[model samples]
Target chain A: MTFEVENVSKTFVSGDSDEEVIALKDINLTIETGEFVSFVGPSGCGKTTTLRIIEGFEKPTEGTVKDDGELVTGPSNQRGFIFQNYSLFPWLNVIDNVIFGLNINGKPEKESKKRAMEYLKTVGLEDFAERYPSELSGGMKQRVAIIRSLINDSKSLLMDETFSALDIQTKHKLQNQILKICKEQKKTIIFVTHDIDEAVYLSDRIVVFSRRPGMVKKIFEIKMDHPRDRQCQEFEDLVSEVIEMIGEVEED
Target chain B: MKKFRNEYTKETLILPIILIIIWYIVCDVFQLIPSFMFPGPTDVANSFVRLAVSGKLFKDVFDTLYKVLFGMLLASVVGITFGIILGWSKRLETLCKLVISILRPIPPIAWIPFSIIWFGIGIGPAVFIIFMGCVFPILISTIDGVHRTDPVLIEAAESFGASNSQMLTEVIVPSSLPYIVSGLKVAIGIALMCTISGEMIGSSSGIGYMILTSTSLFDTGSTVVGMLVIGIIGIIFDYIFTKIQERIFW
Candidate 1:
């Protein structure tokens, strides 16, 4: 699906105070179908806010998002969101959690379970189908969370720092796995994170945001081939370039 | 047998055994306390056997059990339904807050007069009293549980195209279960207290009635037996609820 964020801006009023915080300002962008995009910026930047607006979790104060020329009014199954934590239902076991969306949408129970099991098997979590979220490691839980969305056939996946809480090794493995999955499925992905290396490694295009009253500072296209080498000079240079942009925002 | 030999079981048994031995010595061996005020262990045991043989104990136990369970069932249905609605809607919760606060503080025993006038002195009054005592805790807990449901989870559900009812049943209810169960735990104790107090004042049957009549007749041994039976039932209910809590939280 093609997404157009037309001149979006967000303002937040503190609950007890009259002070207003401008989070985003005149943000405009377009994402092509099946393209992998990343939004990176310093803290208080509107990276997460932009992603939430696109997902229809939050509405922009002064703009609208159009998905394929249709107004995006609210959250739909067409766009799936993965939160930073507590995304899985603790009461549900792995396979059950995976099938939750399908069940809600009124898919056949037998078929839903069968499809959920297949997805779990693909992630090497088939043996853990009966286990609860609390029993799974952080990485494992994230894997389940990812599959939970993917199995619903969402056209675009919105991820908000979904791998930031994991250890380095688990994060790298998941990043690689997500890349493979998106490519194989040809799914559109919009990722929000502060990690520059991750943005350069996974994104086809990276949109950098300025510090709050966040505006789109720059957009970089990574021309590196798939399975890009993290140790290569070209990867390091792009990472540095993105880091410099964020550092400049932080300074301002 | 092995389960009973665990550290927790052994520690728990030590205090009760010591208390029983001290009671046996004071009441039976030394005659330190009058039998009328406090019966000896053998006297209570004899009274227990007599009541059991007469089948009155079984009848009284069943009567109290029926009142407690039935009252709780009614309370659960009403409380959960209202709780979900109130919790889901801020306007409703705010509208009912003042009335709920006023009613919640009034003791269940205080409702005895109204209960008698409304239902008369029988199982109906007893059940009403139990419902009064239990409903608030369950209702409040369910409300708190729903309020505490993670927004992230709700967002996730909404993004998946969950309708209002599906959101309530699938995300809200299950997430709030831990809170509701805890509320039920607190309510069970209140339910038992209401049952006994209601039966003592209004009913002609139940363990509460048995205790009241035995005390009036100066049959302290039988009264002690009645109290012990209530205690045992409380312990059993608590054990069952604790097991349920553990299973739900996982």
Candidate 2:
């Protein structure tokens, strides 16, 4: 199954100024099944805007998003979204938070709870099944958020700078965990990040975006093996290549 | 003495005991306000015992308590329902805002005449007054809670295919719980005040009626007893509400 974006453009009109700001321009990209694609660019580059457009959280002004030839209009269960803010409900315990998607979809309690338990166990958080969001640390909360999104039957995941708020150690650890899980599940992941090194380490192909009214600068295919090492010469070269694309856009 | 002072047992009693002693000296010993106007602590305690034995204290207290609880329960149902609906629908909410603004400012006591004319005396009017008093605070709070719900949470839930009803039940309501609880806390105070005011204005039985009747009869001791009961009940409700909020929110 291939997901496609064709000739997408987004224009935001400022209410006070009545100034029309073009956030994205004529964007075209295709995400094949089971591929890890990362969008890396500077702030206001509309990487997140592009991701949200794909998730159907925001509508494109001038293009169509098709999932296997079906028009995407609004949010659906088929595309899982992992937010940066760790969107676990403060009122729900860890287990219930993870299983919330299933609950909303009318799954039986026993089935949902069992599936929730398996996901929690996969993340080594079975012991915290009853803990509330307030009781968990930042990293732990994000971990729960990730599991919450993944426990659903979504074939594709859209993650928006999910680890930017985390400490470096935790960020690295989560990156590795996400990579391993995505590989095993063979899920299509479209990750958006401002961190070039992170994009380099995790993605199958990196799509560099220009600054404002973001357009695709370049797409580099990282033909490296699993457990990619940042210390490798090839990894360094790819990171530099992605950075140069970003830097070149800033110069103009 | 030091150990006793360190413990709350002694610290908490010190001020109340001192105030009571001063009260006894000024009113009983000096007869400053007259025993009929301001009864001593012993007289008040005696009145409390008399009312308890005669069954009036328990009866009146229970009547007031029942009205408050029943009214609050009604207010909660109506408040939360309207809150969610108005909170969800922008157009309806804007339309109702004018009416709510006009009605909410009029105290429940101010509604006594209308309530008496409509429901007429006793528990009905008292319950109506209390329900009116509590509903606005609860409604507004629920609306605020829903409106202020974290945008990220809404986006996350929507991304997973939550329908509008699912969004209400699972996301909006639960996320707005803290605000709702706070509104309930404020509403409880208003409910009690309205219940007492309604009872005082129209009812024949209730702590408020007891206090009003005792004042007219120059039974200051019984009036003091009634006041103390109301204060204690309010404290207990606040404590219980806090405990429940902590358990659910924390």
Candidate 3:
């Protein structure tokens, strides 16, 4: 099912001031099923806001987001969101954290555990299943957070700078893992990132956003397959293109 | 574990020993205060032995323990439940905020008169006072705990399709556990204090009653013994609670 964001504009009012701040202005996009798309922009560009709208966490002041012609009302398991903060439950162990969505969805305990373990095993964290989030490293915790959403069989994954907090090496490693998993599952992804390189490397298409009062400046389709070489001329070219687009937005 | 236990034992014993030596020097050697007014450490020890043999110490300990435990149980049940509800519902919190603000600052001792009038002189009033003392701390802590929960966690849970009740039980409650636990710690201290105060003001039994009667009769050693028991019990309760906190939260 295709997801459509139509003429969406969001306005935010500060608690103290009467002045209005338009965070997003008349943004529009269509995300085809099983396609990988990335949103790249500077801070305050409303890339995160756009992702939030898609997940139905925040309603746009104008326009609508439809998933296969169904109006998105509120947060649903159908559109999974991976936060910048790992947001793994500190109290729950790795396995339990991974199975959280299934638990909330009322799946039987045995089946949920089996599904959680399978995801954990794929991430090679099955051995750490009983360990709490505090014991896991940052990358491991984020993996659990991803699996937490994935086990629900969400139609799309909306990542909000999920790797921005991690070190470069760990971030790249996780990017590879996420690419592999998304490809294997053929799940649609709308990844938000400030890193143009990441956007070019992972996304089938990149939506470059302008600064404040965020509007789509350009959309670049990457004509490459999975496991795109980061150092390759074309990959670097696309990354430079995305950077130039954002740089132009900044200049404007 | 064994190393930790040994260190803990050694650390705990050192202060009490030093304090006892100082007490011996002041009251026994120097005879700073008259024997009837302030007892020596040895005298307090002798009083403890005497009370233990006579079964009065155990009985008073039991009486005080029963009141604090019973009151704390009731307080926990009511406090945590109401705290979660109020913390989640802004309307409920707004309705109760003024009442809580008005009631919270008025110490459990302030409710003693009403408790006595309402429930009479013995365990009833003591329990009521202790419940009042314990409940507010637990309730406030629970509210703060739930309120202070990381917004990111709530957002994550919502995106995972957690129902409101599921959010409360799984995310809100468990995440707030540290706050609730610390609250329970405060409640334990307050509960113990209320139990003793309640007993001292009106009851014929309990450690507080014994201390009151002994002090009035100039039985300073017995009074010191009661005071020491309460202090030691408070320390033990704190120690146990800390252990539980370490196991659960850390």
Which residue pairs show collisions in model 3?
none
Off by over 4 Å in 2: B1-12
In candidate 2 chain B, what residue range of length 10 has the lowest lDDT sum?
A: B1-10
Q: Tens-digit lDDT track for model 3 on B137-207?
A: 99999999999888889989898888998999989999889889889999999988998899998688999
Q: Score chain A of model 2 by TM-score against the reference chain A.
A: 0.96
Minimum summed lDDT over a 10-residue window in model 1 chain B is located at B1-10
The best candidate by DockQ is 1
Give DockQ per model, in order. Answer: 0.79, 0.69, 0.71
Which candidate number has the best TM-score? 1
Model 1 bad stretches (over 4 Å): B1-8
Off by over 4 Å in 3: A167-170, B1-15, B29-32
Better of 1 and 3 by DockQ: 1
Instruction: Give the distance in Å from residue B212's predicted Cα in candidate 1 to where it truly belongs.
Output: 0.5
lDDT of 1: 0.92
Residue-level lDDT tens digits of model 2 in A126-208: 99999999889888899899999998969899999898888898788889888987888888999999889999899999988
| Deviation from native of the Cα of residue B20 in model 2, angstroms | 1.0
Instruction: Report how far residue B197 has shifted in candidate 1, in Å.
Output: 0.7
Model 3: how far residue B146 lies from native, Å: 0.6
